[model samples]
Target: MTPSAMNMTKEQKEQQDIDDWLPITSSRKAKWWYSAFHNVTALVGAGVLSLPYAMSELGWGPGVAAMILSWVITLYTLWQMVEMHECVPGKRFDRYHELGQHAFGQKLGLWIVVPQQLIVEVGVCIVYMVTGGKSLKKFHDVVAPADAAPIRTSYFIVIFGSAHLLLSQLPNFNSITVVSLAAAVMSLSYSTIAWVASLEHRRHGGSSHVVDYSMTASTSAGRTFNFLSALGDVAFAYAGHNVVLEIQATIPSTPGKPSKKPMWLGVMVAYLVVAVCYLPVAFVGYYVFGNAVDDNILITLEKPRWLIAAANMFVVVHVIGSYQIYAMPVFDMLETFLVKKLRFHPGWPLRLIARSLYVVFTMIVGIAIPFFGGLLGFFGGFAFAPTTYFLPCIMWLIIMKPKKFGFSWCTNWICIIIGVLLSLLAPIGGLRSIIINAKTYKFFS
Candidate 1:
């Protein structure tokens, strides 16, 4: 045998250590806390901070509806994760592209992942950039009001995002874990901070729209349109499921341990944490602002100079963590298409070239999409909704191959239908808005 095969490799030693640590058990499920925290990490990305502002635009009733619809989309994501695990056993996360291809087809996976990688992931980066920019501006303005400007905000995002990408390429990717943990703390802290701020705002008779459940007993297609349109926003909030694939390679294969539970636990934890974090923020924000809340909550928070710094710090940390997640797919795609497919070698020169391209692309998109809130709305409504909702549902139908279609199958179909209807609703609303005021709202122009 070769020397390498005769000795313990790094991967082998790591696996042995994990096996010793976790041991092997017959349990098919993770403990509640494990499931809870893993999902929470994934959910607390920069998007949660922007949510209250997004919902305020539609009124409290529509905003809450948006939150619930987003959760519905999240439920489908949860179902997909469960189904993927059941079908593929220990390797569901590794074989996400395979699952996509198997469940749908090769072409479908390509379509799904391309936009997922390019638009969804990159768009998310843009959100973080804009959000971070705003947060930094807010922080700076309290101390030096004259120094804040859109250009300065733009510069900060560029520096911040580039630093993350550069740092991620270092040995062991150690900073990723640090950034992730910090992000969790910051997000939770922000939730607490925003809640306190909202309460204080309300105590002083703050006129923000917090309650607007004025639903009419009318089913006119025109009136119900905005509620339907908000489905895309929900889908955008639920788009973190694929994140498991990015970190799946890091999972240790313990000899005695049940393979899938640890990973599944991670996913569920991310979900709960994010859901809890988002809910209160949305509720409190709507309650405080009512109809007048800024599309971004940071704009509406009425805190002292010190508390504002804390909130801004939280936003910055969240953005740092987000860049790591977004970079994974982009790096993978470049490695596949450039180095392997196109026969270019992987080295420092190539890495720098790829990194520069990503920086440029991210900056252009961030600047081009002015008004962070509107960008989220447009992307959520048009891009995220269709990709998350329609594609997944159709793929599940093909993958499950139900003989008589039980309750689970029926529910899956219903979700799919809802997603499709919801995806169509956004553009329909956009079209209607254009028709009403073509000169004013120039979708064509």
Candidate 2:
């Protein structure tokens, strides 16, 4: 029950009923670990596997700097978001757009925040759809007999998407906690497997990997494009900020203690786990494979047949959870619109049709063109960079209105400059990479 259970105003009662029905607000009993694994599940995604490839494009200097900077910058912005969640007493901004509506005003905030947030959420779902499918294919190829007829990658993708048909119908954030926890554990497992496997491969005479550290692209233009694309890959990793508010909404908040305390504690633990999973995978995977590292590190380490198979399966599970984490917010937005704006009744039929349709749409899109690296870069720079890195800072400045030119203003401005640059440059490389992949990639292949 809500804190206002004692109240009995007609409109308040009605609003409480809607809140009870909605996905995010329906549960508020999630503990700190819920925040932990949810953040871990959201933060450390399959994108960590691509860090080596991103590092390769960036080379030693920019690569190292980009990795460290993104972790710090996004962490700072994340703290800002957690603080702002209950900044106004007695009210909680349970969703990202709600916070935006408060900071930018109702109408303007929707326009400013919804499109980018939608792109991030929808884009992540599509990317994970592709990832889940690809990992399945990779696993099948490794364990199955070599002479067996090769399955089309498209078929494996459909099989992977089929899982979501049922999973999408899960009621809300609370319902998926077990799934998220499993996914978070699997994420850590596979990331460890990726780096450890990379090291083992290196120990065994490099297993045909090219060990040179020089930029893979020969031409000046090609290297520049890759560098820009790599920025997107790194940006894609620290994307938990996208769903932080929604995750916090699940935790019970009260006047004396507020939700931010437990939420921030969980975030710190999550970030620590992130550093453990990310830094080793990026540095070790790149150290072993150099410029020739594949976009997904697990794909590169194909030796130790059984372990490699297990890692791929882990990836499949992890991305499934990641896909749901990003999708829940979108579901809330859609259902809220249907019930409130369109006057549709809130019921199981609405959730089934709306959520299923959204999942199927992402599945179709993922099946049609699963350019994994390109999607990461494109979505990361275009939307991830903005939402994860600077959108919160922008909101904080607007809402808090700190003294001009003070340390607070300076820090936010610096973050904004970096984030804005990423948004402008990253998509160019990502789009180019997609076009290049398309030339050789038969549709639905």
> Which segments of candidate 2 are over 4 A away from where they belong?
1-9, 207-210
- Candidate 1 segments exceeding 4 Å error: 1-41, 82-86, 89-95, 145-151, 168-175, 205-230, 254-258, 427-445
The residue-level lDDT of candidate 1 at 13 comes to 66
Q: Quick one: best lDDT, which candidate?
A: 2
The Cα local distance difference test for each model comes to: 0.59, 0.91
Q: What digit string (tens of lDDT, one per residue) describes model 1 on residues 189-253?
A: 88778767877878766644355543321456645554443444455666665554445434544
Cα lDDT, model 2, residue 433: 98
**Candidate 2 local lDDT, 302-329, one digit each (tens):** 8999999999999999999999999999
RMSD of 1: 6.8
What lDDT does model 1 reach? 0.59
